[model samples]
Target: MVATTASTGALPPDLFDTTTLVSLAATLVLLGAGYAASRQFLPKDAKNSARVLFVWHAFDALIHLILEASYLYHCFFSWIPASSVTAEDLGSSQFYMPQPSPFLGHADRIYGPQAGAIHGNALAKLWMVYARADHRWAGPDLVVISLELLTVFIAAPMAIWICYDLSMRRSRANVLMLIVATGELYGGFMTFCPEWLVLSENLDCSNFMYKWVYIVFFNTLWVWLPLYAMYVAISEISDAFAVRDALAKVKKSN
Candidate 1:
């Protein structure tokens, strides 16, 4: 991933480049489509809260599986071309090199780099495009990668299952949603806090999209939404317990 370039005291030409625009557009389109589809397909009898939960978690699960999972796969399995420079040799260099073709069962030699650069899969390259926009994510950050691995592999599927249970109106869904919401809230904070605390200098606030949209809004969405889910879960659970208590009292009186 390309980091901050030498400060020319002027804005970088590629600050909000074509890649960023494309990515932003694709994200918005996907989100809009996913929400609309969920609204259309979910049972009309379902509660509004249930519908919202289904849409959000369904979207989250798909993103984790399709987008974040791809990043994780490339992080572990992306092969550097034999003729390309190793990661160690390319330390802190501003030069951008195209990553080799993604490993799709077998490597495609035709698209693989012949020399002088490390390569990642198609998804990884897409991720790199976003990462390169921010100084904090220039290279592979192990902390973020580790968290993503868990989220993509475990939490995402669990969220999908919870959504299904919620659609069925299972009382246990509240507990599961609480659990998933906690994980999301924790993951969201851990994803960026350490970097902000320790590597604040590397942060690039040069671009409005990178700073506000990507760093602040995109990341905090998980935080706020998860918190809301957790609130709903708690309220539902408390109501359930209160009803149970009332039933018990009536039985005792009888």
Candidate 2:
């Protein structure tokens, strides 16, 4: 069985060793510079900026949902076309035998039955980003993947509805938008708290960027964004009730 099979006891060597660190630093500098440029060139009104940001945020989230869903669908279902399979040979079968690759195959081992050996294997290092976020759970791949699926199916639609409402009802929508944006930003931070803690406790895992940065940061939205949505929903419902009460009082007076 693939689960019991021992790997070659090796890792995919760092593709960028020295150059990677330099590139990473350069990327951060560019991001910082871009943000500064936007702030300087873009208009300073809070309302206008928030409106633009909300639209972009919604679209960004949508794109992320699509890409992640594609990854998951390919990972668990082995649905990618034969030509896309990376193996070198037909290996006595016409159908492409799904061997593990960096994106899809690794997820099955980490989140599926073969997780025990996968946990200790060097290949697992690639998943350090997600692992660092929820090390206490010892298995976040399934949870994270599930959440990503939910985001694609559920959260993305809700975000769209909220965005639509914002575009239509400026005052009310702006309030909800602010609330959601606050929640998103806060949740984004909370998602990474686990990674920060993990790095503090285990410096070895810090070597992998996924472990300390991307995993928790990327996967955490499913956990927090829902809370924000709920808050907005409750507030909207309460406001509706208030309007009903006000109309009833006016009719009685008349």
Candidate 3:
């Protein structure tokens, strides 16, 4: 795959010679949509805190469900016989497939997130661009698969639930946010730390777009927001406890 990936061609030349701009624009548009939903649907007197929570989680649900789920679809559905794979199989898309890809070496079929490069599948190509940034994403890396499974299935619905809870003023939103946000922080750690321990072998840091924007900036979106979610949860939990304590003190005094 490496022998031919270079010969295949360069990344798409538009949007900073990469799909970075496209992905970023889409993210901002989704986030903006989320904010608009909060403004239009959430009650007028709803706290800014709830509005913010609603917006972020709504964005989270859309990203995880629509975008990230395609990754799983490629992994589960996309394939070709490796024995018949050729240079023409990998076209103009710049995603790499490791020479003797660990997943393909022992199989008759090759399955990867790079399916877009292989077959012109547009949805699969979305991830293939990022796969150029991180090679682990190019193939069926087990750790990545496991993490994505949790992300698409569990975290996504949890995000939607958080949005509903925020809109309804449910106290359970605090616990849900705390739990899922902690899991998200853990998810980011597990996704990268194992690679770090290996000196980031599968990570391609050869360019600013791949290194800074894709790896650092995009991935950290999950981290930074989850930290904020945890803070919000902890603060509300503490406030609830304080109110309970004050009420108990009044009852005892009476």
Candidate 4:
């Protein structure tokens, strides 16, 4: 039942390959749910762009609330002993441990973000599947956790607000989209830039699914979507400014 690997240790990918397929189906289901919601929640008069934004933001918010939040949960509550001797003393605590454990060097204490597979924590395994792509997901990596904190608590609510604004057809939706999009781009950059600068030591890109689908394509969405949002926001704002200038000229002429 080992889920994550080539991170702290090399685990058999074939054994857990089915987990990847299952999680992929679930992710698609989550994404489809967002689009379905747009039909119900968005107004008929709403533009196609609004509909797309609504679906994307809704999916983003849910990811923060559901999947990412679950990661935080395991980080906070899941535990495994750092010391082999401590693990022995704990007794019955080691039903399914991570091989080449991230916590092994620390010794004498419990560490987490690696939930026990014995408990049948499907969500943890889902993350572990992704952790195989990026080691940072397998343990308590500070940068990832900090970025996720903002992503979950702050970005999640902002994304929800954007969805609400899009549904309501409010001008503030543009502003919110601009803000959230900027934050997302910044988060995406910070998440990977350092790793890139350090030659991507924490990343495993050997697998096609891990490299193309999970790391590249998934991360690219944040970049592309946010850039589009920023464009929309700036365009609308510029139009507003032009209108204001035209009105000022009319007043002076009168």
Better of 3 and 4 by lDDT: 3
User: lDDT per residue, candidate 1, 1-254, as tens digits?
Assistant: 11232444665566667655666776776677667766666677988788778778887887788877766665455544434445564443232232334324334321211121244344544564556444323333556677888899889988878877876778787898898899998897787677667654445555565557666677777988788889889999999899999999999999
State the TM-score for model 4. Answer: 0.84
For model 4, the stretches where C-alpha displacement exceeds 4 angstroms are 1-16, 84-107, 116-118
Q: Largest lDDT belongs to which candidate?
A: 3
List the candidates' TM-scores in order.
Answer: 0.77, 0.41, 0.85, 0.84
Residue 228 alpha-carbon offset, candidate 1, angstroms:
0.6
Q: After superposition, how far is residue 77 of candidate 1 from its true place, in Å?
A: 1.9
By descending TM-score, how would the candidates be arranged? 3, 4, 1, 2
Candidate 1 residue 219 C-alpha distance from true site, Å: 0.1
| RMSD values, in order shown | 5.9, 11.3, 4.9, 5.8
Candidate with maximal TM-score? 3
Which residues of candidate 2, in runs, are more than 4 Å off?
Answer: 1-60, 77-147, 170-212, 219-226
- The total of clashing pairs for model 2 equals 3
TM-score of 2: 0.41
List model 2 lDDT by residue over 28-132, tens digit each. 554454345435443455455444444444553554454445444433543334353234532211222233344353433323211321224322232222233
